[model samples]
Target: MKYFLPATLSAYLARTYLVAFLQLLGVLLSIVYLFDTVEILRRAAKFENVSLLLVLEMGLLKLPEVGQIILPFAILFSALYTFWFLARRHELVILRAAGLSVWQFLAPIIGVAMMIGVFHMTVINPISAMLISRYQAMEANYLEEKESTVAVGEQGLWLRQRTAEGGVILHASKVQMPEWKLSGVTVFYFSKEGDFLRRLDAGTAVIENASWVFNNAIVNSKGRAPERIARESLPTNLTVNEIEESFSTPEQTPFWVLPSYIRTMEATGFDSRKLRIHFQSLLAQPLLFAAMVILAATVSLRMARFQATALMIGSGVVIGFLVFFASSFLKALGASDQIPVLVAAWFPPVIALFLGMSVILTTEDG
Candidate 1:
């Protein structure tokens, strides 16, 4: 429980770990950005309206999300590299001979990993979400798709659809997703010149085969008297897939705001399973990062004696990939409601931590 270590040793170890982490992050981000830019360019080439600059902008906007996905890998590699370098320089051996335990030497690196996780969830995620939202909107516009403009907010669900006349704005006080039904709906009709023509209020609206079926509706024209109808059908290009796809992804929501957003989504009768999983996963990030440090130490601690640097590094990466795969698979199960969110989110990191600790104990203590 004692947090004290030799000040100079702690500072040096922490600085080395920090430098390695930052350098690894930079290298990973650069590789990701370059690959993403190339992919985006390939996709954009098919669209006549999308320019090179726009494609680059979209790629940049999407980098944060990609970076987040790769962060654990970055941490794992950085920790491995840092510990290997120290071992190669005989620093770790000297410290061990001086009566320093493995845990004592690992303390600084673990602390740094925890802080990086916190910073990533708090600051980096929100920025990434905002940029991704913008990129999606721009991409939708360039593709001339109505589905991209749909959004759910405090007031209700809002949608924009294009027609031969101009556009239609649809608002619903409440939604039943998966079925794509709406209650307390209002539809605004507009002319081709962007002039408002009339509005229709419906007690309920249901999406049906490329159009919406409104029951118990009242139509009010700009210059005509209001007319009531028992039911009406309006042409729509909105589909079930489009409506569902319009909602901001759980990852797009910031960690700080996820709780409230999850509540709102649940209250509106929308499925919040994905959001719940994402929020829990964010909460588990620090532990996951710490596990990365433990795994790194396990792999790299013997590098000086074995001198199998390449093999050790390769093994570390394989382990990292396995961990990533397991986490993703668990997340998929969580999102589909096959397992409890907490179990899906926390189990991966917890298992990884225990596994890493077991390896370290067997190697270092035996």
Candidate 2:
């Protein structure tokens, strides 16, 4: 009975925070889906074949990703509401009079927020990735009229490039980093007008001088004898960066698979800065949630004491946007190598955490 009361209060606070968070999330996602559906309809208007069902499906598919994008705001607004609700009913005053510190009660809310972050990172993200990939495919096929151009797998690297005739397919069994060097390279030449022109089997190939330089290549063509060539060159408009950029974006990659994908991209001599930052950001999400909760608590607690509800709510909203913009700026800097990935990914949360702590300490203790 001694500890039961405190435990019950903690559970109540956690439950309240979670319920508020979910309510806000539901509202925000609904708004996002509606706006997105309208945007999809507008974009699809040009394509007469686009159907209403497809548009609705696309909107539904995007909700998970959109939910994540608005997570921080949801946390902030809900935490604010939860704290304010408790204060409005004088529950916090009663708890304080019973000698419970702010941190003791805030602990449960922060814990719930952290659990939400972990769930989002581990469970929600992979589902969002899958759904968003489908959304992108639908968008591309129906709206953009684009085709997937590149892929990497255990078998090797494969590339398809459009030619005026039809297409050219290239495959490499092994790739060397820092330069576009390949072993066991095969190039297939085909035209849309005809089935195929020829195939080239190269023992080694390297991209240089805006072309593929093959060493010890065997050329095979239809109705012709295979010809051996010591050196052969094929013209290519592709650059290494362009090829790298053509692959799926980080948001399209599943969370659990992102680490290995990052390593693979790094091993292939592709720039993995964006992936690193993204992965780091995921790692920092729990702290970000905690920081948001603290900031929300700081504002809500102040509002409760001073009864400046409007000013405090507005301040919380401003803080949320400021944190978002600062994080985005830092991410851009990290992508451009101006700042360290760890710094870019971590600074905003750390700053917010400290800011919230300072305000709460001064307000509550002083």
Candidate 3:
């Protein structure tokens, strides 16, 4: 019992160190890939076909979002890899023979996993959220400037309308397709050259199957006399449907608002599968990390004399890959409503836990 901490700590340190290193490498690689892709798109956006500093900034900001998804699998694979090597070198066997149970051997790894979960939830997720928000802003600023129509965010809503005469920033606060009315509206009209022209704020704007009707609107026209008009009757060439199509999707709601965002999205009768799956998956992360440790122990721990360690290591690597892809596929299935979100989110860790336990039992009895 007294020796348990030292042994576990040693193993945890080795395992987590390898995991962190691999994950960092993966993150850097992803950053490079994202940078190149973003650069290509940004160049296309430029008249001279050149990328700007803001484009690079946007890429850098997007890296954390990519890392949030990739780091967990990297940690899992790294553990498997490190453990396989330790087993191949016969360290696991020596440890087991030295009166350490497999559970004891895994204790440190599990601890590391828990730490990772906490770090991800408390630190990495928030950081990724901030980066994603920043990236979205940068992307919108870059895009709406060039395109006549721009899609912002994932919901295929909140579009931008550009014209040779002027540009408009259209905000669709809420859309009621059944009533053909858009509630809570704000529009920013810019000069033909993109200078600020006027801003229109409306409450309960409606599209009456034809023209747009602005209710209780305040129009602030800039330049010249700098006039302000407030009236119940406002006419515009912008239609409700057209304005709704012009703003970026409301799906761009900040990550900090995910709880309320999820609720609001669900209430709106939208398919909440993706968000549900993501939230459930977030809740399952600690278990997933814990399962990874158990899996590493089961695959890498020596149970039989004269066993082919190389073969076992290879098997562990294969199994790790299978688990990773299987989890991802299940996540996709859940998002598409082909499976229950809870099942998709929780099954991977549950399945891994069972398999690892089975392996541990098999080894111990033999």
Candidate 4:
């Protein structure tokens, strides 16, 4: 006969797991923030005008991005510690002796893990995205001492390139990738002294070897009459890969807007595989968290007296590192189109969950 825990017991288990998770998250975030602050200070050291307050502010702004990276590990360690603590107190043993299966007691922890994953995806991700974007902008403005070469927003795609005589700023309402073409294009030419020299409007622009081939171009020089040309070639240093890389970074866009942004990018004929992979990865967070919970249970359920705690903890750490490495590898493959995006983002968690569950089922009468 199998025993089941009451709702009250399940709730208590969930509360315990939640508390442990929060404590671990706080400690991990603090450590990450400290390291980030030190790194920011080191970078700011190169700029005499930069202040410690500003460095600290940058660290604070970057904390959420760091926290997001560390969250899965936090969940893994929290579950491990919670299980170890319960086992040390003989709580798990008592519950098991009462005829309850291991799976029965694991229910609440898994539920909590899923909930945490959902909360992270829905709430924390957007906030982190905004902060990270701000952090990058500030770092560029202050630390890098240079403006970004490319930008994408609601208005259009904007690019800046330096030429021997002057700099050119280009705007394209639409971009067609692979062939590297732009439509509804406009280009502004400025002299080295920051004086505007001329402007050109073109119906279409195609990237050639070292210049843009504008078609149906109308040139408007500062003091000259407008001249119309069938085609004009202008020098540029920007490359197709560079432009795509700039706008396709997943971190720059919020989770809530990724779908729409992906659609827009696709509409502009840009290959959005990377963004698609990232979106799928976000959707798989809950499953990954659940997998971590199962993996933790498998490693930490042994009584402290029956095995060396250090060995178990070390084993868990190694397993966690392996999982992360495999996930990263698969993501790379997915981004490069070696595998389907959905497979890359989801296979690791699914495999981890099933493998952990299988191990538990075989080792324990769950």
How high is each candidate's TM-score? 0.95, 0.87, 0.68, 0.90
lDDT of 4 by residue, 1-366 (tens): 645679999999999999999999999888988999999999898998889999999999999877887788888988988888888888888987888998999989999999999998888889889898899888878897653378776667888877787788999998876667799999999998989999999999998887899999999998899999999998766667766766647866788999998887776667778888888988999999999999988888863537568876887798789889999899999988999999999999999999999989987888
User: In terms of TM-score, how similar is model 2 to the real structure?
Assistant: 0.87
lDDT of each: 0.87, 0.86, 0.64, 0.86
RMSD value for candidate 1 = 1.9
Worst 10 residues of 4 by lDDT: 145-154
lDDT (10s digit) by residue, model 1, range 129-204: 8888787777677744443268777778888877777888988989876776799899999998999999999999
> Ranking under lDDT, best-scoring first?
1, 4, 2, 3
Best by TM-score: 1
Cα error of candidate 1 at position 135, Å: 1.8
Residue-wise C-alpha lDDT for candidate 2, range 18-75, written one tens digit per residue: 9999999999999999999999999999999999999999999877767777999999
The RMSD of every model to the true structure, in order and in angstroms, is 1.9, 3.3, 6.3, 2.6
* Candidate scoring better on lDDT of 3 and 4: 4
Residue pairs clashing, model 3: 157-248, 157-249, 158-247, 158-248, 158-249, 159-246, 159-247, 159-248, 160-246
Please give the TM-score that candidate 3 achieves against the real structure.
0.68
Cα lDDT for residue 118, model 1? 94
